[model samples]
Target: MTSATETETETETATDAASRPAPPLIYDGHCHVASTDFIPRQFMEDVAATVHRALEAQGAAPPLARLVDAYAAQHQDHDADALVAEMDAAGVARSVLMVPDFSLRMDCPLTPEEMARRHHEIRLRHPGRFWVFIGADPRHGADGIAAFEHAVTQYGFEGLKLYPPCGYSPSDERLFPYYEICAERGLPVFVHTGPTVRSLDYEPAHPMLIDRAAREFPGVEFILGHGAVTYFDVCADLALHRPNVHLDLGGFAGAALPDGWPTHLNRAFRLGLNHKMIFGTDWPLNRMTGGLTRLVREVTEGTEVFAGVRRREQALILSGNLARLLTRKGNE
Candidate 1:
């Protein structure tokens, strides 16, 4: 019963819709839930203690317990509603939520399985808005391994996040089993590759510690989190030489020096490793400095961190590279 003119119009509209290019991807490669439930109480206490000692040294002392309470108060957004609103404002299409297992190393209420379930629930609540990277310390033994495998096989978690500062080398034999799962599943591995709070063991997180794993597990992609701001040259070198190794700009959220971030990033780009660079803001951790909008602007607009980067390359740094990594091999 449709008119010929109406049919023609509809056909034209469909063609136009199909022909239009997809929107550019703006992805946040790293972030976390700003909730105390996910972060361990012991970790909070350590952070509070570290800050207190630092302040006392500088002679700007505040009561220790008060500071601890303040730190606790900063993490109220359990559901990430505020984070989603901010991401929308910043034009971030998706984010990777990193849930590191602190149950073993710290006094945490939630076990590894419970934490993984919480992240899976968050992913379901938001659908395509978030991807999850789960962490399971090798010290958790068989139970931890089972929980990690379950998250990937049943819950559809995307990647693995390892915190070496929790006291284990990236090259540890215990982590090999996890690496095998990542290789088989085509999941990337993100390792904490630099200094953290004074509480954790810093020596274990040295950049070179990942070299052995990078050489051994060529099938799995290894991303050095906080690579930009910590051991920049060494991390860039690893990404430059190793086919499977890459770097994420997680700690650049608070680049204070005028030329600090740009200089370090340009060095990597100059080494022809632009594609190896993934844009990440350790959100909520750096939320005190600025919002996601500011972080996005610093990398995408004007003559700043991404000044000389072409549109195509900029696309890779912003989201294309991550999109490629996130694609499961079998699906492709």
Candidate 2:
């Protein structure tokens, strides 16, 4: 048996050891609170099925039923206060939220104004902990552009998020005017670059399309969402070639880190582009402790892919670099 003083000392020693190599200050660069009303039910179903299969294939316990339950819960709640509380618990200093463009396609009944309003409310409620980006669909044509302007100017939204899976290329004429709006306003755009679930036009989601737009509108900054995962080679090429493009690590650690993540990241870091990256938990979609916590552990200790990276470099990946790029004295 140990005395109370000894127990206290031992606990303090453990705490000190844990604090020695602390995780970086995180600014979660992508978080979505897809409305319980609008986001596709099918999307959740597909996700549950995919993870269930992945678990069974790996012989993981119980075949992802708990994951399915979590997905169901995520789809039903658009609660901002809860999200902020979760952020506090997870040690995330701030999170950037975005309204997605899937509403029109999935037959969800809501207008751009409604979505923007909801996201803006979250921002208002948790001012420092949250910032928001509104989505614009070029297919809605001039009406879409009008709504996007309203979102930025009316709601004080800081950015735009586009889904190419909605069937418009970055270079399409329909989207050019929206890009112009972003350029003149100095707002960064987060464009989805990976394969979409049951996508309508896969080619439009290609990362190369962004290269064209980046060249054409040099004033506008673009963020390649998911970092184009499998198409990372082209994505890296774009980042290397263009000063206006950046990548966010939102979906890469999808449903658990897929094999080769370290290799993919190693190549990117080797190419000397770590500063162009941002950390995003892709929260709710990814549970904080399981995914984000695991990532912090793997990367900090140097996995096969992240071997021997310095602490400051890992800090940069986690949030420091993102702070420099985002709005309103973020780097400070």
Candidate 3:
């Protein structure tokens, strides 16, 4: 029943849409290879128990064992096939996949070395889709340092993943040797910078704890994971003062922050922290919140999140900064 003029207009609009340019590709600054064996069983149990208790309170309870099994099943992507599909759909050009060392704090099936190997294999399979970071607790002493060096020199890992909540401060002297290796290789270090699950020691992971290390290792870039979620004000302050410090928006989508993600991001932009901000979805961690596609669209599709942020600054956050940081190391 449409008139010829209206039908013609519809066709013209479709053509215009098709002709529009694609958005710039993104480089996820923080992510993980979601394999249950790589993670601590106690941590998963704690998460499932919390969910089970909440469901029970709501009279929608499933058995605890079933809930735990379901949770474990959700993170069984030992291979990067599913991750690459999600990345392609989300237009993510690459992701930095990190393995957190929990051997000292919890019971994990694979040691840090084994976990690194698994990630290296996945990277080999995916070609240009991933950059791997090996986790090593300095408490492991000489053996740990050797394993980390081997991962970097032999396995092609590019960065260091520090889980401060695993009961160590970022500035702990024991980590100096590891920092020395990273500095020599021009690799960046990603430190968990906010509260984590109750099973871990959250106090040791404060953003301020990284200040000393940032000062000590001026050449090594320090990225505060979950920086845009909790303790954002402190994280922003640190990034503003320290040239070596940066922030990653990994848990921004899922964390129940005070003013929400867009507001927090806009505030950071207002404070001129846009250039130091890095895009990250934390992958399977935030999949419940519409996955990577939704996170990308939130920053790129509209002017809401980037209203005050200029296009160039937005690019810096989405991929430019991470590219410059990682590629600089690779080139050297």
Best by TM-score: 3
Worst 10 residues of 3 by lDDT: 323-332
lDDT of 2 by residue, 141-232 (tens): 77889999988888877788898887778777788888888888778889988776763467888899888789999988888888835477
Better of 1 and 3 by TM-score: 3
Model 1 C-alpha lDDT per residue in residues 1-332, reported as the tens digit of each score: 99999999999999999998665579989899888989987787887898799799999979999988888898888888878988998899899999987665788877778888888888778878998899979888887788889999888889999999999998998899999999999999999988777668899999899999999999999999988668888998898899998889887856554677767676666667888988888888766667888777766664766667677987898888888898957412
State the TM-score for model 3: 0.92
For each candidate in turn, the TM-score is: 0.88, 0.82, 0.92
Q: Which residue pairs show backbone clashes in model 1?
A: none
Show the colliding residue pairs in model 2.
none
Q: Whole-model lDDT for model 2 versus the true structure? A: 0.74
Q: Least lDDT summed over 10 consecutive residues: which range in candidate 1?
A: 253-262
Who is ahead in TM-score, 2 or 3? Answer: 3
Candidate 1, residue 253: how far the Cα is off, in Å:
2.1
Give the C-alpha lDDT of model 3.
0.86
